[model samples]
Target: MRPTFLPSLIVLAALLLCGCDAPVDHYPPNELYSLVVSTREMVSTQVAADDTTAVVEAWFGTPVQPRWPADQMSGSAAKALVRLDNLERAAGRVYADQDDLHFGLYNEHCVTCHGVSGGGNGPASLLQNPYPRDFRAGVFKWKSTARNARPTRDDLIKILQHGAAGSAMPTFRLIPEQDLEALVDYVIFLSVRGQFERELISGAVQELEYDEARPSDGLSLMSIVGGDEESEALSFARETLDRITDGWARADDAVIQVPPETVADAASIQRGREWFHSPKALCSGCHGQDGDHPLALQTNYDDWTTEFTSRIGITPSDREAVRPFRSAGALRPRIIVPRKLSDGVFRGGDDPQTVYRRLVTGIDGTPMPAVNVSDQPSATGLTSDQIWDIVHYVRSLGESE
Candidate 1:
């Protein structure tokens, strides 16, 4: 009465034959499996600094332009304008007019801590425990590479997108994707323009040094025998300026695509909440019991900022040195500073994925440690899904706070 073995055998054979041409595996193609773009491919065509203004007007509608004295305009102001123009173009449609974009982007995000002109003059800049950057000099403290030299465009992008783990520069991922790109472009434009201006002034000083020397002029106490000869010194100074200018040109001209927006989900938020409160994770210590609690938790504790700085090997003096150069405003309760998450600083600028990157990787040289929950059987390091959830939670915090 059961089905006959011969019929079943015939059916199985037919099914197998039909499926033979079909793929046995359901996995995606190799390329689709990995979304990372190679660095070399990402490099953009170089645009000339002189052409930037034309490009800006062509791309984005004209708005009020900043007026600088004719003499000042020849130097950094011109460069800043060019760079700003180029950035506006690359950022697509977010920036209406250059000045408006500049004021809006910098004021709400950077000026609160770094000050309007980056002289560390912003209201909150004064209150920061460490102070803000003075953009006039163009020196940066936290850099991507170990050398701590000038930051690359990519470096700046990373900092903007993810924020410095222990610093007040909140991850800017929350900014609309286009807006974030525009912001990144603008920041670099400012730094490059500022550096160029500084270099021009430095060149003038070097010229003065050369003029001061006589036929019998000897090396100063600072320039001993091991130092460069006069000709070499002149060459070196020129070369340094050349390098800075060249960097500006390249950075201004390079085109970069904005990263896509990352949408947050629910499961990740639940997990993130747990991790935030867990002793092993220790995020709750500073962030507070429920992340909204007012009492200063270990994570938020003033001492932790110092400890975080030490862990990253950043000296207090170094923090002070760069404080004035920051164009972004003060690191306050609501403003981001070198340490502390006053306001929703850490949660402010960035998107879900960027937040995930910060949580997973921690920062290169700061107190924020990598959160690795993979080892625990009961918990798992946040998957992409979980990270999105955390993003929702963080965003919710913004509304509630």
Candidate 2:
């Protein structure tokens, strides 16, 4: 039973279609999930009336009056994750105070495309071929970490310094370092907040009894266990918060360590070419032979689209099946075709080390896969040396003929 937000979106759409009101130029209180839903689990929870908003609000506070969850996260933990001052600067609408000093850095520069809560549904979002990156998933594409690992802080800073190639994300290199730091901190804040919401919803689905007291009674997810600081519910909430924050704290340790580049001798390049098309490599499956000659180019969806569509059994190509969703505020599906390797434009940086990392971890949220490697002495998979050959072969493909 998925929660349907169709009615609300329908009303909004009708208002627009009938020209009943002026265009929506500003979005107030860009709370996550206010415009577009975040996860299917969230949808299901809403239907069951098992929503976790009150609990999440209790932990993170409302968009207007944001809280820092100091009881569970403070001092060093808070510092490592995000600075309160920086986050506050980036959190709200663009404005000034008594001295007219600028606040709401995020809203000033990012909200039009990233939405208030970083849901990637900002007013200008759908106009782009690929919508802006949604930070809530806590999964970033151009990162140094291995599969499913949290992105290191440096990984984020680098992205800000150099905008993601082949996308509408422009570089903020000219901005002051402090502003960049604030934006990055705000991104982490939105990501952590989104993940926290999903985790709480998931936990409630698994453990919450239908008869449990609701938030109106002052007993929601966090205080539901016994309504006290020493209660089991509070402990569970604290542990969950700690787990999420600890992962971010440990992001540096999870980066893939790439071996030095294998010299691109003819033989090495030849072996790499063979491995590129090898049955086991599977590179040719989506990216065709020699990197871009598929029998017929097929449409592919990134992880964000997969989250709500194919993952939930809604076929992406079936228009009739998808119209309701779009009308209800889901963005129109955009095909993310496999990159033509021959183009030689690597969005995740073209350097050997970066490419090497991409090969080892694969591109997050795409069809690209990490090469299989044999870690065990007797295990059967591509060894590190073999992967290096493939890397060389890939780099060679980009070289001018």
Question: What TM-scores do the predictions have?
Answer: 0.38, 0.80
Show model 1 residue runs off by greater than 4 Å. Answer: 1-117, 122-133, 136-190, 193-230, 238-266, 279-281, 294-350, 357-386, 399-401
Please give the CA lDDT of all the candidate structures: 0.41, 0.70
lDDT of 2 at 209: 36
1-401 per-residue lDDT for model 2 (tens digits): 23568777888889777552222232223232321232444334452133456556666664444556766763465446777788777666567789755677787778779876677887899888668887777888899998988898899989888888877887889877887888888888887777776666555545443123333323246454335665444555667777777778889989998877778798998998887888767778777888866433345788877665777677778888777667645677777877778777677787878987888888888767887777642334677777878878877886855
Candidate 2 colliding pairs: none
Off by over 4 Å in 2: 1-44, 47-51, 62-65, 74-79, 95-102, 210-219, 222-227, 230-232, 294-299, 375-380
Error of 1 at 120 (Å): 1.8
